[model samples]
Target: MILVTGATGHLGRAVLDTLLQHTAAHQLAALVRDPAKATDLQARGVSLRVGSYTDPASLAAAMPGIDTVLLISGGGDDDGLQQHQNVIDAARQAGVRRVAYTSRALQDPGTLANELMVRHFQTEDYLKASGLGYILFRNILYMDTLPLFTGPTVLETGINLPGGEGQVSYALRSEMGEAIANVLLQDFTDSRIYHFTGAAAYSFHDVAAALALASGRPVVYHDVAPEVLAARMRERGVPEVAIGRTIGFMTDIKHGQESLVSSDLAAALGRQPTGLLEGIKQLYQL
Candidate 1:
């Protein structure tokens, strides 16, 4: 059986939805901290293994009878590296054949001083050292986050950021989940890594044009300075830490860190991934 950690989260749920289409529900299990939150999954005949990555004992108890485990990256404020280690160790102890990890798609995570990417790199290193076979899904930024970066009134105010002209090969989260599920259904004898990304890299200017086409209204992209963007966030009462993180990601884009386009996502899906204009329309419901 296959078990997915963080089963109640957005990407986890999307993976489960696609898995259910190709396999029987009884062949799947979910690793959840609270079974109450996963009642829908239990009703669908998927076994629920209550566990927490912070609690090694819980993770160990959740691993019996599972052939493979998908360790979805944690999003909490706590130490994520140790949590991932706990899961990996538990899976190893339980004799799980393979462990799949969701990681960031960066050519060199050390280029930037971002703490999150550092942890991802650390986790990947630890997983590699662990004796079990592994699959690494180095995913790029999601198209779903476009709304968060640009405000709700983006159609009127335009896309203003410090990302400069650098482009991101952003893939839809749902499509990435589907591709991950496809990998999970296959044999896990050989370990592999995939750079899951969209078909093309696009800049904020391309995003503006896509928005204009989708909404049938004029839109613009303003390449503001980092200090100017930070000042605007301060005016809007955004937290200082969040402002720093936002600027850090924009800087990574400015340096072309997320500009690599890969065909792995489309190869997994057996078709070309959605283009920017179509993805924008789907995201905005336009």
Candidate 2:
């Protein structure tokens, strides 16, 4: 039996939908915090179990009769390291044979990074010590977030951020979900790590060029100082924490922390991953 946590989320739902193509719904289980939101899954014969990473008993309650678990990492209000540890410990007590984790790509453990990444590295270390067979899917930044970095009138405003000449191998969230499902469907005895990323890396300037081509309008990439960007965001009423996170992400990109390309995603899906220009064009609805 296979159990997937965060089964109602965007990537989680996409993964469940893809997993259904390869296996029966009766063989699947979902760990959801809110049972009300998972009615559709229940109607489809998916076993719905109530659980929260903050609640260890709930996690243990959800793990029975499950052989493999797909643990989708999460962070918001709760300490991510503790939350993942809760799941790992519960899985251990439940005697789950294997665990598949969704992790971020291009993070250096030695260097001081973002708070989000620090928590991820901590979770990875804990999972490594758990003594369970695991598959680490180190996913890249999502391509859907490109439009968020670009303003509403991106065609006119172009791309403005603190990053300079940094490249990111952004992959589509849905595509990555399919890749995860493919991995879950396969059989493996040894623990492994896969870098699920785009086929090519693109800098913000390259993104602006892609936007220009897609929209048939002149677009430019402007590199701004972190303090200046934060000040502008503050003036625009962005929360201090949100501003800090944005700056941290841009700083990481500027330092070449997310510039990585891998064929693992394509190999998993048995097809070429989506191209940068195509993904950008779709984001713009062009």
lDDT of 1 by residue, 135-169 (tens): 99999989999998988999999999999998999
User: Model 2, stretches more than 4 Å misplaced?
Assistant: none
Please report how far candidate 1 places residue 265 from its true position, in Å: 0.6
Query: How many pairs of residues in model 1 come into backbone collision?
Result: 0
Name the lDDT of candidate 2.
Answer: 0.89
Residue 235 local lDDT, model 2: 92
- The clash count of every prediction, one per candidate, is 0, 0
- Lowest summed lDDT window (length 10), candidate 1: 107-116
- Every candidate's CA RMSD: 1.2, 1.2
What ranges in model 1 sit over 4 Å off? none
